[model samples]
Target: MDSINVSELVERLGSDEDAVRKMAVFKLQGCVLDPSFADVFILEDGLTKLRHLTLHATGNTLAYSLTSFSRLLEVDKGWEYVNQDLVERVVELVVTHPLVNILRGAMSILVFIVSHPYTASNRISQPDSFGFRALQPAMTVYPQFLEMLVSRLSSADHALCANALLLINSLMREAITNDSEADWPKFIKQLQDLDVIKAVYTLMQSTALQDLSHPLIEFQALTKVLLRKWRDVPVDLNKSDHRRALKSIHLASNPERVTTPVDDGEEGSKKRHNPEKWRRLGFESETPAWEFEEVGYLGMMDLTEYVRQQEDGFPKLLLEQSTKLSEQRCPIARASLAVTSILCEHFEIEKADVDDAKIQLSFESRTNFDKVFKPLILQWSLLHTAGLQAFFRLWQTTGAETEDFMKIADLVRILLEAVVGGATRVSDVHEVETEIQQFELARLRHLQMELLELTYEDHWGHHLGQMRDELDHEALQFVKEQRIRCLLAGAWFSNGHGHKSDNVAVAKQDLNPSNPTSQRYAKLAHNRRFLHYADFDVRDDEEPDLEGLVEKIDLTTVSSVVLAPSEPSSSTTTLKATHKFISTRKVTIYGYLLANSRPASPKIHPRMGSTATKTPRKEVTLLTLHPQTQSLAAEWLDGLLMLLNYKPITDETKRLIAMVQDYGLKIRLLNVRFDDMALAGDSPEIPSREGLDEDYYYDILGN
Candidate 1:
């Protein structure tokens, strides 16, 4: 379609006769699909003409006009012509239009506007831009829009249903990308309120649809966002309402497993015996040892070890049943597992059930249940904060009243009590004192084991009794130590800070301790009294001694912690020179308390017949943590960061801190806070302000 043809059709769009206008719009819809048609249409001012049709035109005229607009808007530059008024009219059409074609056309225009990268970016950076203005009414009337889409998901028209799913998928993708950190949780809650999950799940199960892939993909995406939102939002343990909110979005129950009959042919036999297929289904391969040797040494060794480990028929059966319970291929099953994985990740479980199924299925079994459930019970007893939150989220999501899940629930309650008790013990002090000593490790161990063993009368009980009888001192001691560490770390990070005596030793490098950095310590010139009054005095001969002063920073008042720049002389030196002069690693602690100048003595000096001012002045304090070793500096830096950045005072923070501590302890670091620390030498240099105007400097310097 040339510009001349587009201009001719556009002129006919304003004709007095209704038939001529309708024919012009229908033909223009096809023309607008051409890339060059948008420019000529814009030049002809066709958007303004289409805006009129959208508001007044009905039936095919409105639909075709919308189609033309939708196509024109596909061009990146076309968004500049869209305005808030046109968007409102299209949204109105979406709400009041009776024909499915008109509604879909309007929605298609919206989808193009919203999902465009340029428009989505502008939504945040330039809220008053055309794209954002267009989105306002659509967002305002989103509830009705969502309802319409949900209703269309159940429509008998396959094309309408698919379009609805496509629109929904696009909207969700945009929401996840753009609004994830903003209003994503609210958006997710809205989806739940409308039962979009139920509708989508129903659509997935519909056999009338020739291909289930599109709906399945949409369902998976929805599940991903829900799981992501749930993980992002922490649940308050103290609030019953917060815990109850997790149960609001119930996923469809897991589909029952059914065995399909096999054909009595060579192909059927090959399918039944396929090792790769068995592995994909989460089962042990039936391939022979010779076949394993054909792979390689590493593969053969791995298979050999796995096969040897599952020698017992009972254990093999349990593994097979557990694998079946997880059900990898089903979309609903994968979603359920994802929910479980999110719970596990939040809880800080050491080994989460990612794609592989674990012993979780054992909890559902009644026959020889204790044997199956014992390991998991013991593992849960030693869980970190993340693990506990995982368990809590799982308990809430499943709403399971089963004895096994109840055990997790009970563990959560007990852990909460421990946290509260820890907090209560330190409520009187500014910092944790003897609370670590006060916590009876043995009693806590016994309590945890008691809780974990409550549901198990057979295997766990008998196993403990046998171990006691055999006097397995080393094994029992190991378990006791692990349980104590888990409980104490969980409780301490949840409520208590480190011990008051737990100060990290550091050296002050910016100024010598013997000569205080405070200006108040500077000697005053008695001869120049006017200069002293003007705060510009020369130093006197006699300097007040501050040789033995010791500086100690109380970390509780620290507002920010930042790494200080390392000296270029040390960092850029050759290997031998670098060894000779080791770089001094430092971290700056900013706090109001640290800003107070050192107090001067009231006693007069005999030589000058005067005393320095006793009053302290407030200034920006830069207390650098200078440790002898890099690792020591990293340890303190990480600890201060974790301390300063900790907020919201929720159970989730407790679990995370506990997880860090647990991992650090396992690795045998100096402290639990030694995460990966970036060297200040590697940081980018700040841009110098040499070319700035004098006024800019004055503004910055507060002149």
Candidate 2:
């Protein structure tokens, strides 16, 4: 309908003739569905006329007016004109109205008003304004309304039950937002008094509602909310009857297993000791040991068994629901799994055991579980974070052994594929000028590092190499820093233990006490006090004479890098001042470079000179550069690690490197420079470097 027709209908709503007003309201109800008509209707004071009709009109007219108001209130602007008075009138109608149609319409208006208070401006300003308006009508009547809704849950009409479920869910959610911590328990107690849980559970287990997906899904959501809220409420085990009922439910849900009968024959004995049998039960028994009485004891105990051993609680009820829902392949199954995972976390249950139990309980076999969960993990966006947590825990547990190593390898491959997919999406953008595009690129790089860490072992080198070959080198750094981190985490750096070095080459030099140049050189080198030439080229022919500097000052006793007290214009000036004074000026630092060096044992002489004694050793630092800014140093370090092809020495070091990559330590490195700049209260002035723009830098770095 057009705006002119809608305006004409609104005018007719004020007609003296009852049939004319009823017809106008019926026509306007359909008209209000169109946004333009609704805008025009509201503009023509249609809500005032509708309010009158809701009070004076009967039957279909009242229903149509309520329905129109519900439709109009859906628009965000519509709520601006809605006041507490209108909400109270609707709540009154909901309480007094006996007709199903009027009740549904009135309840729907309340639903839209209270649905997401944050979505409507006026509602947020007064936090749960609609809920308070609806429920504040003499306390007794509001409880009656709640009881009325709960009673509808058991009604034969599916539509009534569904509407009732939706409104209850909305009201419960609003209560959680508005209700204070102290009052929350009282509110829950009120719900229990009305038998709300019983009614919802009836709807959940009702075979009649099984085909009705909408109501069933809403029921599942309601169950999750109730479980989450009730988790904090302490269980009352003081009552003997309640405890007995709880124990009965727990035993019924988790029955003791029936042990297999042992036969005296050779075939039965072989069957009892079969490795495949133990493996199928989630054990890693390659060969049967006759010495051990209980072979698969630890493996057989899962989360369910652990929970059963503890005192009976509400989680057992949720676990039962989850197990039953697992038989279905709908959204409710996913919801059930998510709720169970959350409960497990709340109870401080071991994630690995929970994952194992989830798989064992949900699927008929390991292969079936793998087939279902593998795709879910690959499509992780479809799963909730709780579900993902469970899946990752399972993967971590299974991946620790050789039995399910292929599955772990496949998971690594899937993660790599996701990284590649992210990069592909970034590349697909026409110009990577938007912050979102940059974020996508960064997210992908992070994914790459995580994958690198997961496959840090040498056995998974082929997968890592494959990913490296497939990824764009210009875009992705290819785990170069992670490899260097692994090397640093090893004993070589941490404990000063040496490994076989392949990067640096040291020249053999004779330490002769009689020759002054050789003696000074040995003394200076032994003292470990030398200045790093920042601008010195390895190809430079005019190197500083260490013997000449050593004669000027006793360099043997110095134990730190000596710098010029004043800023030097050239390396020559800095080298000349090495014997004068120590300086603390901060310079632009880069990174460290590792070089292969052979160790020489010292043979002390009476004249403060040592002879060269050859000893086998590994790598040593060729040069060390202190970082003025962490981010720049990280980039330089990554470049060096990539160029040098460093690898971690120990498995523990590899794990630590993997953890570092997983935490995005490289990304964190950028924060140091930004924080320093922030502390200095200065905006970064970009140097005139090629392929750099100030605006582009701000676009990427700014929020």
Candidate 3:
């Protein structure tokens, strides 16, 4: 096409006719391939028309326009024809365009325009060459563009999300170049703040998006850049610091800093600025492998520190999602494992860095167990098998010597203490009944075998045996010193609130918009449910303080633990409670605290022997649903019977027992059994069964 035809085509691209505009874009695509057409395209203001066509055109027309634009920029000396206005328009389309394909096209054009060689000759007259000048417009609008692109990462449309990722990667590549160098610290910090890297990683791992074809290479490129920066650049250690200031500290910034630069064929091109030549010479590829191949002792410590940093700043949403996705064996969970494994490898490298003789075995033992391994193991235990595999792989690779065994021993001690608490149990017979309980037991057993193997008959004199013996002794002593403890909660009923103690304040209920009158009735009812982690301690004489969910009940309380079925409500209930059980299965504990007594006689209920005598005792009845199952309620009943010294003698005691029996409660005597000597009583005070050879069992009922 001549200059006259270029001008006509540019005019026709802006024509009202869609077909005319599409034809104009199609012709321009061919014209842009010729070296002589650059002047005609520039003089006729073709870029402005092309940008308009890309934004306004639809379907094939838009695709044609984008192709034409990219070809124009890719041609020799083609970038010099571009200007700031045209760049801005393309970026605007990239950010706001509804179609994923169009967005990808616009992004492609933008990346090409920014990175393409601009001048006719490759030689640069000055530091601010054509490539640098062309990129200045992009840098000016980058923050806004980046914000928009990052927001698309969470789009339900995987294709849109994938394109958004590619756009961001391209933008990052352009920004971080030597020509228009981004502030690496600031740029990376912003990406982290937006959770861009994490979001990309999650997208890569999402099972929901697994079937959809995505730009994995682009995603990898973006994450690699981010990780490279995370390792290379200094970032703020304290995430809570809003400023996100980079610290002066640096660690292994460049392992191959002395690698000489190679001369590229581009005569006047700076080798340092030419990323392609650097990639070709293998500096970028080779350096990471060398630096990360083996971590020294300090490097291991550094890895530990990185783990700490990640754990502390891990997002709450991700934590919640981890539990849900862990069992799914999804990409996100695998990604977490991959990350953990890499860090573990770093630990191995670091451990190798320290000579075995010079290594402070005691310090390594303590730090590995307490600071590194134990904390991770405990926190990730909920991850089940995947979590176990990660830590186990680390353990197997890093150390298996005596110190490592000691660390394992230390880990076992912690798990034992946490799971058993103060239970006097050293039995091999585990009550691995429920799935959760079974998982806990299995983990304990795994740890036990692992620790025991180091101390068996062959290595009797090893420190492992001594540690095992100490552990066994500690276990027995702990069990004897500790009282029985269990979690419980308060369940609300039709007539009254579940919480019997006035000390327990009722939580206010939320107002219902549809039925405003229900709010007033809720206040009048005064019954509030308290459901939180509650503990019942048998040793304390003080009444259980109902603070939030947990409570500690006194064993000295004069009362009985009764299981009662919930009474059906006579009045209409709110929508919130409609789906809930109409009649809840519940347990009610009746007691009287002497501490709440007054000299004056309280008004007794007419049904109770109309005695208005002068001992004002506060009668308390705490009610709650059976935690886990009703069998637990029965266990509570039995435990309370043992602690409160229950026996029916007086009519009142018999009546209470009869009342408990009336409510389907199993009334069993607290019977303690022993191998050395059997207590001669229908009921024994301390209901624990122990023998010199057998494991301990707490028998609540006699044979």
Candidate 4:
């Protein structure tokens, strides 16, 4: 294809015809791809034209222009063409573009410019050079760029988010690997000030990346460079205390509390009548007319103030966000847990840096552990069973990734031991109860006991032994003895640890099968009234029997009650009494009440419809009833719906609770019928069927 005229194409870029402008951009893309042609094009001021199109063009036109501009740097000596103006224009495009492709293209050009081998060193030492001018502005506005990228990482478009991550990774790689090494420390400190580390950590956690190998590698490298202690660098206590001093000054000078008080003439005249005032007021007094000393009164720092100053910083934000995110079951939940663990680990390692011989954790480390890890553990105990199981699974899978996952494994181990220790604290039981609310304390106590039972096996016992080897033997022995005492007191599994058993075992009565009393009891049990479907033949005989072949249906199998099957084909198959019984697995059973039965003994006949061959078929009853049974049928349907909706105390319910409390799974109860209404000291009331409305006890048998 013949190349378009450079001057004409440049003019055509501003043409009213969109097609001519796109054709000009397409020709420029071809020119930028070839080094010889790119040099000629740059001589013709093509870079300026492309930058204009990148800013003013809309949609794919802007995206294509960005791509062409990025390709200019693929040639040797391409760094000379870059300048501060071009950098600003590209950054603006990156920040403002609504389209992902445009954003990606702008990010690519930015990364390409920033990652050039000459850009970092030249920007620091030779600020007047072209490379320096291009790169210095990018480094200056990095915090804003970082915030934008972090926000993009949570974007719904995964591909756009991936591009954003790639750009960040490129910047991090350049920052750490630059050979100048002079300004790297200052740059890293700036990154920390922007909270880039925490933001990236959060982004990585919340994203749905299938394979985190690349991003994790980049993050681990960044951490190794950024998390280290600065050698021989003295702490700048002046900068650290600047914020507090400003706050204090602002408080002292606040006009709301420091207004000048005006004296009324009556009081002034009365004071002037005194002898001392008359002697001092020769009209030339050394003291001021009104004392303003009260305005300068600033109180000394109280205990609460000191604590608030310490707690109101980044630590507080971390604790609050981590607590809230830990209870969620999204992909980010584990990441949140992992990041919290890493942060706590970093603090511990920092505290230990002061003393080489110290094996015990410093007070600061212990305090941070309590702040970051304890609330998360407590919240997890209440809500997330899936998270707990995933934590344990990660611990088990840490062998292949020894260095990578060791911190996570250690944190989980510490949480488990802490739970056990807290549960078995006999001396602090009363104090612990007093510190928190009664309800939360009881919940914590219950969770601790449940976890103790779950962790009593061989794998957990081995883990405990490993933890014991790391701690002092005397301390370990004391904890073990306390655990034994708690277990023997029946407190580990039972709610009431201090209460005595009410009764001993009683003797069992023997049943004589031949006795009339035993036979009568057996007959009653066998003939008990259970709601069921009675199947019979649909022969051309006179009428179907109301009581024929009956099959029992467990009320627990019923998940929901719909008015009828939604199948349009079956809408005309029955009368107005049609209803359905939906199972937990979503199997639909169509049935309606018979119209000829007695009111006391309501009967239901199965209406046949769609059936899956794999499902065990419920027997279809062919019964007919009188018109009076319709009301009884409606009552039975309403009662069954109500009963199915009520939460029951079955083994499945117990298993679900255990899963949530012990495993941190995200299972929640769907049918919430009762609240924890009983007071802490009230006797538990047993529910009975006597207080129910009339519809609840509709008899299904004509005994």
Q: On lDDT, who's better, 1 or 3?
A: 1
Show model 1 residue runs off by greater than 4 Å: 2-4, 118-143, 180-182, 208-216, 234-339, 342-703
Task: List where candidate 3 sits over 4 angstroms from the true fold.
Answer: 1-11, 14-19, 26-64, 71-77, 96-102, 114-142, 156-159, 174-182, 206-214, 225-703
TM-score of each model, paired residue for residue: 0.36, 0.36, 0.34, 0.33
lDDT of 1 by residue, 1-703 (tens): 5435777777888888888999999988887767776777878888778768866788888888888888887765467556676677777776666788887788777767666664467767656444333465665865486676667777776766776676666666666656635465566557657777666655544454343344434445345444444444443424454433221211111112344456664343222222233333222332222222222222222222332333453233334444543332222112222224433443333433322222333233333222211122111112222232334344444443334443444444454345323442113221222332243444544465554445332334554355444444433334334433332221101101111111122112233223212121211122211001111123334433323113334333333444554322312211111111125454444432212343223333345322323453222332443445544444444433433332212233334445544333323222222121212124546789888867643345555
For model 3 the local lDDT of residue 683 reads: 41
RMSD of each: 30.8, 24.3, 26.2, 26.6
TM-score of 3: 0.34
TM-score of model 2 relative to the true fold?
A: 0.36
* Clashing pairs counted in every model: 7, 1, 6, 14
Q: How many backbone clashes does candidate 1 have?
A: 7
Taken over the whole model, the C-alpha lDDT of each candidate is 0.44, 0.44, 0.42, 0.41
Off by over 4 Å in 2: 119-128, 132-134, 138-141, 207-212, 229-703
lDDT of 3 by residue, 1-703 (tens): 6544777877998899888988888777777878678667777787777767765678778978877877776674445445666666666776667776666667667656545543445345432333435545665776477677788788787766766665566555555553222454466556657867556645544544432223433444344343333344222233432112111111111112333444765445332332322222212332222332232222222333333344433233233433542222122222232333343332232232112322333345322222222111112112222332333333334443423433433443434343433221221113211222333534654555444453332333344345455554444333222212322322222223323221222111212222111000001011222223233322234333344334333333323444453332212121011112213424454444333332233333355322233454444443333433433433344333433333212233234444433222111111211221222323446755555556668979878
Looking at candidate 3, the ten consecutive residues that score lowest on lDDT are 517-526
Q: What is candidate 2's lDDT per residue for 3-89, written digit by digit as tens?
A: 346667878999998789888888777767778777777788887888778756788888888887787776644665556666767
